[model samples]
Target: MLQDVKSYLGRCFAIKDLGDAAYIFGIKIYRDRSRWLIGLCQSVYNEKILKRYHMENFKRGSIPMQDKLRLSKSQSASTPDELKRMQNVPYASAVGSIMYVVRCTRPDVALAQNITSQFQHNLGDIKRELRVSCYSNAGYLTDADDLKSQTGYVFVLNGGAVDRKSDKKSIFATSSAEAEYIVAFDASNEAV
Candidate 1:
């Protein structure tokens, strides 16, 4: 199949001589033959970022972001002096590097990554909500803005979220039921 693909592409795409794709785009791939398992990681990439930021010896936090933290545009640099200082901070690059790790291996960090990247120029509050029942389990709004509600869902297959979304609902949902419906519809669409 690979040979056929190589022939079809007609040499424009050069297949690297890397021996079974152990690494691709900063992700390290691993395979277990007897267990029939394949795993992906970005530990090396993560370490590189940490080193780049001079945090190689920093203590690890138990949680990436604390729950119930609020971020707003007001927090952005409004003055020219502040903007100049921000330019030297490498905030965007750090967030982007973090995003790549989130995309490749750390699904748990999706919400945090979303909030950070959205406000790359400007962003945090966290809320913890657990589902108690189908009807009663509508948890706290992950988004604090009154204009829109955020909805996130992950479709887990073989222990990974193969298709996942963390985004705002297209329209404002008036009630918890309406929000639930929108989430259901989004999840089902991805399932199909």
Candidate 2:
């Protein structure tokens, strides 16, 4: 059927068959006809980013971000020397690079991506299972700068993550329970 359509289109327009795609826009593609499965990966792109950032020798961590990690504006460069030092770091560029990976094949890092993006002007370090299930959580008043809660959720499908979000709530929650409720609402909305 694919060949027939290709031939039909070919008759009307100039076209070339490059055969099965192994890579597109830097994401590598893999297929298993016997199992009828297809997969996309960006290991090469990821490695290049690591190399570009001089993190090729850094130790790997089990999680994208440290547990209970909190970032605030106070952590930003304060003094003239600190500001000068931060100017040399490609903070925004690094975050943009990792965000590309997150959007493409790493939903597991969505939370980290969201968190890091909040501090684009401050400069900072850059940093999945499938089950057709979702998990949501909130950190009450986690944003020290605004006293807003942080909400996050991830949806998994077939042992891989399919959707995710991590961001500060637009409204402040009165309690942890309220924060959780908000996150749940957001997750449910996404599920629908």
Candidate 3:
């Protein structure tokens, strides 16, 4: 289905040129000058969320969540839905900010956000785990920009992400093994 709403908005505004969409403040824009192909992105908005959050220099880990991060009592999983659960240990803002980033650019980040958002109300264990240091299941996807765009996935079994991404898979995979091999191939290509 047509997941993106901007195209709907475009029809509403009846915008002729899709060129000026790059610098809408909350969005990121990448344009192929030679090809005159413009790409609109929300990365800037993600960065802005970080700035507004002010967690830019704290500590950037490879994954969004920690290892073996649980939802036991007296932890971030407690409370029906309260913010007092998160006491110290910085980065909730960053976590939330990244949620927005993932919402904009990455769909694989869904699992991470689901696990982290639980702590939105209760983050005690989250803060403690990160401090000492320490992790759900979910999938999230935002409005895709282009037609048949390949979504990026960063597989994370535990809190730490085993993989990170730059681009989406190029070819369509017919099976799970093919998908893994494709990602591996993509990584190898990027490594070169």
Candidate 4:
């Protein structure tokens, strides 16, 4: 069937069969015919980014960021000397690089990515399984600058993350419960 499709396409269009795709847009592809599983990885891209930022020598951590960590504009370069020093740091560039990874195959880091993204001016894992499951969470008043709540959720299908999001709520939540409700609502919307 695959060959027939390829032949038909070849007859109609100027196309060449590249055999199996090993990499697309820098994401490595792995195939397990016995298990009928295809996996994607970006470790090489990740390493290049780390080396670009001189972070290849840094220690690895289980989680991207510390729990309860709050970042705001207040933490940005405040003094003239601090601003001058920050001028050399590619804060926005670094964040943009990692964000591509988050969008592709790193839903676990979504929350951390979202938090750090709020300060682009300042700048900053997974399992496989079968059943589909979703998780929703929110941080009440987590944004120190705006006092806005943070919402996050991930959808896992067949042991892999299919969709995820992390962003600050547009409106302020007066209570943690409210924040939770907001996240739940957002997740429900995404699920549908």
TM-score of each: 0.47, 0.58, 0.41, 0.57
Off by over 4 Å in 1: 1-20, 61-65, 77-84, 123-192
Between 1 and 2, whose TM-score is larger?
2
Clashing pairs in 2: 130-159, 130-160
| Model 4 misplaced regions, further than 4 Å | 64-68, 123-192
lDDT of 3 by residue, 79-156 (tens): 544444345445566677677667666776788677766655445543444332211111122224422223344444
Q: Lowest lDDT 10-mer window, candidate 1?
A: 130-139
The candidate that achieves the highest lDDT relative to the unseen native structure: 2
lDDT of 2 by residue, 66-167 (tens): 547678887778888888888899888999999999999999889988988889896633222312578999999898899999899997655456679999
Put down candidate 1 lDDT per residue, 38-118, tens digits, no spaces: 999888988999999888997553243544667778777888887777777777788898988887798888898887777
- Compared with the true structure, what per-residue lDDT tens digits does model 4 show for residues 1-192? 988999899899999777899999999999999999999999999999999999999755342244356566766777788778888888779888989999998887888777777876743101222455789999999989999998999987645577789998899898999999999998998876
Model 4: ten consecutive residues of lowest lDDT: 122-131
State in Å the error of residue 158, model 2: 23
The TM-score leader among the candidates is: 2
Candidate 2 Cα misplacement greater than 4 A, ranges = 61-69, 124-192
What is the C-alpha local distance difference test score of each model?
0.68, 0.84, 0.53, 0.81
RMSD of each: 15.6, 15.6, 13.6, 16.5
Residue-pair clashes per prediction, in order, are 7, 2, 8, 2
Give model 4's TM-score versus the native structure: 0.57
> What C-alpha lDDT does candidate 4 achieve relative to the native structure?
0.81
In the predicted model 3, the residue pairs found to clash are: 28-41, 66-134, 66-159, 67-134, 69-135, 82-121, 85-123, 129-133
